[model samples]
Target: MELLLSNYQPAVFKCNTPKDYMEEALKICETLKIASGYISSDALIDLKRIIELNGRPRLELLIGMHYFDGFTKNQYEAARTLNAFLQINDLGFVYIANTLKFHGKMYSFTMIDATKSAVVGSSNLGSLYDKVSRQYEADILLKGEESSLIHASLEEIITKIGSPFENVPVTKFVEFNQLLENHENVSKVDKDEKAGILRNLTGVKFEIPIKSKPKSNLNPYFGKGRENQRGYIAPRPWYEVELIVSKGITSQPGYPSNQTFEVFTDDNWAFKCETNGDYSKNFRSKDDLKILGKWIKGRMEESGALKMGTPVTDNVIAAYGRNTIGLFATKDPSIWYLDFDASK
Candidate 1:
């Protein structure tokens, strides 16, 4: 019997506004009928907007925060917006953050799964860095089996990490204390120390850089009235490429360093380099070179990079020598080499 598998479709969006992101997401929501979402530190703002625009309806929402001690007034307002949305929709929302306790501070990972459709993104729900970043930087819409998995996971997490505010009824003045007590992950420090760490980790934490927009120009071949341009007028296909570099620690000190750079086409298959760089510089001995070579060759063989039916061979490597070497170290003793088309 033939086995069938479900395809994964992950969208990468480059957008400038919350509205645009929401519209795109809403379309996905309508198509997939998403029932729940998990929001990390960055996606809370847009999540709130989505809930509000969709008539403040109940949905499964799980919010995760790394730290909460330094949130500003505007940031607090964003949190209020989120709480209001949850209240009106009668939705389940979970806020996870590190907090200080009267005894000892602890960090907690929280979750809330009250709705079916869910969204996750890389934006915060506040004005903490308004001029620098959007309320939401990016979003991922989860549906079908994946959506169900996320919901279940969040629910399980929340149940395990019981909330302090679960049954408490408190006024505004005591709400902060409630949050601190409820969110086990929040930490407490003096004003001076908090400011110092804030300054030190400014750009390293949660600061998404604004990407410059590419200049758009009309294609000469498909100008204005040429809406139905045929054949070669189609846009070039996009390719996703990755380069991975790693070193072996288990082997002796003289063993060669192993590095791999892979180029993946739209098709799933990858054009991989099995052994095309020098490891002698780091290894400093022939034994290291041999060990590294053996290790790399095994990996390539396992990946079918040097398979019998495959067209890629030492010839192809020799042809791409310049490009391959450019990706690795220059001073290594063993030059880039390949041996292909060997009988099995």
Candidate 2:
């Protein structure tokens, strides 16, 4: 059948079943010597098979990080894993994109071989291959006029993924996934009451700088004062470090730098509950702050965010947001850790 749709809920179009569509797409590329499209699923099995085929065509791929159903840890992890896999594999070039702002889903493809064809559907490549689990999904292969529309849509996505935003390299993508996994593991460790209690009262582990103006003096309540101070803000005796909970991972479009976590602290500690710059939101309970501190520290160390320069004293700062975290030096924030895309 030229126009095929899989047998699944919300029936969509496809030349083959959901399970085999990916392989079919790859085979088409192999013959056509060119393939370009977008995918939202993380179906590794299909991906592996496609790679083994050695299509070696001029292929361009864009995988969606955000989903319409909703964003979940499992989904995020799968996307990261798939991105890493694509990065290392000889599958042409791949780019990671997230349209979380609109909660957009990109479970479609525009494969151009000897002729133009498209697969538009609700199913992701990863879910399509499932035998035990069932998620009804479908896709339609289009030619002629319909294929032209798919190509145009893909061109728009490519345009947005350029300039200040660029495709993530394999090395960086893999490192970020590893560190994120480490952070999750460390977060599950038993909480140290003493350390948490102590950290709740103090922001960083190091000694507070005595020379700079104390945060309390500049603004007693910590709101106005913290907001105004940039570059280097002196800590006050009663200052508790405010950890921000970012809305999305850094480097992705619509990832909010200023997001506040709900403060859940003891009577003794309170978060300033304020916004500072584009990267931080104020306050957490003394306890939550401590956990956040430890998580951030673990994430930083494990991710190599704290890599030392020629001088051991040279260290950098690391940040954690929802599903994404990043590393940068405090002295020069311009330099990003594992910055594969230097131009961006």
Candidate 3:
């Protein structure tokens, strides 16, 4: 009747993920209702895709935290987009519980066969893919009679929390997004000025076209580096693989000014990077530079474009199409894209 979901996976202890339960429930359910502390744009997009693949299932997403802690422009935009898609298909709606603050996370699903199921606990809607943002979370998946029992209570909770949240037939998002962004700006002015990020522009695209280089400089595509691989530093391999940035691009706005940043790859991979050396030229993996090497080299190897552990010459890079990469900043600065494409 009840099952425990845990983010942590260890021997002897059964580990159930929120992703597992939700993904399954979404596929067979005729209607889904969720109340979470907050939501992510990526999560909304992903859920929308799943719902599309499954069938036309109505979804009512009630956001709680944004009403209190505030929301980013990206979140607002994502929610709007998903709502539009659902509306077009006559699927469902998204709402915010504004009158009263809410922090609980719960999901209830009504199956096509009339059975009900639910998940309740710390896991938010975005809790599935954000492995690094949150280290641990737990929840309970309820089914059969237990699920049906909770369904009514959960609807009541959503209704009470979302009460007075909006007038019938919402036209636009409340002024919460811009207000939060403005408040954040006011608070970060001094910090941004000092850090030289005052000119940082959100939702900006940055392309750093890296020209071909010899093995000594950009050794990942080539072979071993000009320097020897240190024994102790092989794990985080910070200096093991390096991609030097041009001075011109370094001066551009929206470039990561920090030494460390997270890049979400086009293929749904996350890589932590460090910008070191003079003028922040060294762009290498923050953890295990070898990973950077493996990713790039592996891509080429898979396509039979270049051999692994071989010198990736100018012709090779040019033939491969795109050598340009770097940060693609979003409205939420925390989410950056380091896209990988054969066509740059």
Candidate 4:
């Protein structure tokens, strides 16, 4: 049990080599609020336990495009049961990437809450290499907001292009078995060999290894180009601001509890305002933001407020959850805090 903590430090773990990947991840999920990972058998047992626990957490697991290679009767049954459990709890859903496009093996898992953690390693979700006494594998747990961006990126990837990995409506189990038993060239091969066959068939490529750097004393959550906390808010690449042409909901991935606004930005980035210097209260409601978004779009299309508009630095600010009131011309630097009455 190699537990770790830090303001922005990342912990590393190993499995079947030095540590048990499943066990450590299970311990972390015991208090998990929201989690996302590449689905495999390595962590399925623990995922089941976590979902069954009280106060089921939100989860989204990515089922690789070639999930049927290691198909077995018992594993099939387990998957069926797990799918049922997930649907019943409404805690999460598994997704399968479009094989035609995404063919990479996703082996990452993330647990995001007040404290964030990310694990990237050599193990898949298979029991063969996930066991304590199995093949060698390792995982890294990155803590704090530094990890939030990565987790957010994963969420964007899964939800944007993947389809639900459901067994209902028409069970994938049958299709899986058919593919397994009918492939003359690979049917006789073991699960491991079948995995290789699937990869070959899909033209999957392993990600290139990244060279690690020495640890730095600077906070990982804050970028190196830190700005003073005097007046203007710092621009976060993760928290982008954009003017959405269409009316829709916008939310930051890891900060689920923060207030969300529908207000359109000059860029597609969601707006985060300064609410008395508090972080959580910076959010605005979608409906309220839409009012402002509609106004901005109308003005932009009319070429009125945006006559000289360069999308590069356009700004549509809104104010809510406070007493501040102001609207500004594009040239007005003082219009940094844009406030509009939603009631209008």
Candidate 5:
């Protein structure tokens, strides 16, 4: 057994990530079985491409988290797309675990030679290659007889509780959609109560640092000048702010993959946002890139925390009290909150 840590602590020690193990398995293993509590659209698409590249080794995915918070609307669509891919190729299948929220990250593989290998860890497929909001994870790799033992266990788990993804209940999906709408439909609340609601029911919330070089005019807030006739940069609307999401929030459910969606900020700014670039790492306003930058910097400017023509470096964000902006997701998928309060 070998322990895998995503952080790669102690440079000299030499470590491999859970992602590395999965990647290797996909490439060489003839059969790969995975059970994960969560998955994201981009991760599934990326996995699909890889499996195709490696000759489509049989792969089965068992999804296990519907009992708690169900999938985002986008995720449901992505899963359908993946199901089609699986069906057309007859390579493998996806199952949703209805008996319980299968929270285990287990991977078992059978190589061409019939030898087996297995991995058990905290990583979901979404976390394996998440560039933004990268998370630290731990997993163990097993081979030889140990791998064979885990393989049988995986089959047993599937037999006991797995249901085809196609067979997953529509009500399971509708429940989450309704939950979000309920949050949005709240009649009224005092300022404090509203704040409490946003914070308390948050699905996941984290701080995102606004990164910029100390001397360059290239702060995401400022303009990256073009040396042509258009030295003048354009202005934007509705407090634009773009952030790289970590641990595959875009992959999770609400945000969806590569599609423009509406989001209302805690400050009451409404805008359409999209995730772009490789692995959907670059997040910004769908219409213009500057919208995201303007939104965040505008808040600082309004609070006298920032001024135009000044670089938004680490010190500036620190002086403003927090080096990162807090993004909170409510049960309402379309509603989100932004926190610019001082860092506690």
Candidate 6:
């Protein structure tokens, strides 16, 4: 039995020349045809490449993390090289590491058997470990029963952690269109044949319809680069305003607890005032309204609502209603219209 431990500090284990120990073990493996195993959280590039070069058909198990430098120019290419090696190799080995944390920081170790000898170390399957100082960083080496225990532990961890990447169903266009249709104001718009396709690809949960109108007092206060228009309400189509009151509705600073706004846009994209700031009566300043408009615009962009020619008129009214009243007061507002071209 031969023992090879890289990354082991003499200060901790009262021994120097950890590299010497690994070299001795590698020599023993070259002489004896025995199996080997390793366990570590970090690996070196040179160690990985060396194992691939030497232990092609004899290496039993190789379990460890794969680390890389994302800032390097050949990062992806180096990764691909490693992947190709894994794909073709038929050694009875396992590679265990989180794929998600690939570009940041990673660690892994491997075990190899040569002839009648076994070697274990905390070095990865790479080429960068040729430097003496980089190879002797941690205390990772065991043999005989101890080595067997480490190998078993590595197998257990691989089984428990499993692969991170798994297939998941993506939302389709019809589903997205149906969700938007569920919203009070949005469904009435003609489903541009393209709209359904667009919504399905991106995952967005459309709000249920709320039958509310825009306040005649609240107007567009913010613009791209224009002067602030104070107390100027844009002309919008008329719609009935209604508030649904339930028992347990509360107010929060940034989020609506139990309040919602419903706006019915006519074919002409006119805004109807609803909620009338009557639920909890928390007055919002002109500046707050402007900020709310910007927030809604951002949300629209994220949800791909702007591309559908969705106007900000209804959103402005909804924000006013939500800010003025608590979030829980109005559950859902239904906006219905007969014509779509009028609004655009």
Q: Which digits, one per residue and each the tens of the lDDT, describe model 1 over residues 228-339?
A: 2221121110110111223332133422245333311111112233332433222211212222222222233334342211223454333333212112111222222222
The best candidate by lDDT is 5
Residue ranges of candidate 4 with Cα displaced over 4 Å: 1-25, 28-46, 67-76, 99-113, 127-130, 167-344
Candidate 4 per-residue lDDT over residues 274-341, each given as its tens digit: 21113342233232222232233323323322211122121321221112223222222211223333
TM-score of 2: 0.35
Model 1 spans with C-alpha error above 4 angstroms: 1-22, 27-49, 66-69, 98-143, 162-344
Q: How far is candidate 2 from the true structure (C-alpha RMSD, Å)?
A: 20.5
Q: Model 5 over residues 73-129: C-alpha lDDT tens digits?
A: 545655666667777898888888888778888988888788888989888887775
- Count of backbone clashes, every candidate in sequence: 23, 8, 1, 15, 11, 63
Clashing residue pairs found in predicted model 3: 236-288
In model 3, the runs with Cα more than 4 Å from the true position are 7-12, 129-134, 163-323, 326-344
Better of 5 and 6 by TM-score: 5
Q: How would you encode candidate 3's per-residue C-alpha lDDT over 77-138 as one tens digit per residue?
A: 55766777787788887777877878888888888898888888888786664333324667
Error of 5 at 214 (Å): 38
- Each candidate structure's TM-score, on Cα atoms with residue i matched to residue i, is 0.28, 0.35, 0.51, 0.37, 0.51, 0.29
lDDT of 6 by residue, 1-344 (tens): 33333434443444433455444444334221111122211121222344454553323222222321111212222333343454466433333333322211112223234222123344332212222233344334454565555555544554444232121111221112121222222324344633433333322122223222323222221111121233212212111112333223313332232333333222222122222244443322121232222223323333443321123355543443332321221222332111111112
Q: Which is superior by TM-score, 2 or 5?
A: 5
Tell me how far the alpha carbon of residue 287 in candidate 1 is from the true structure, in angstroms, after superposition. Answer: 59
Error of 4 at 31 (Å): 8.0
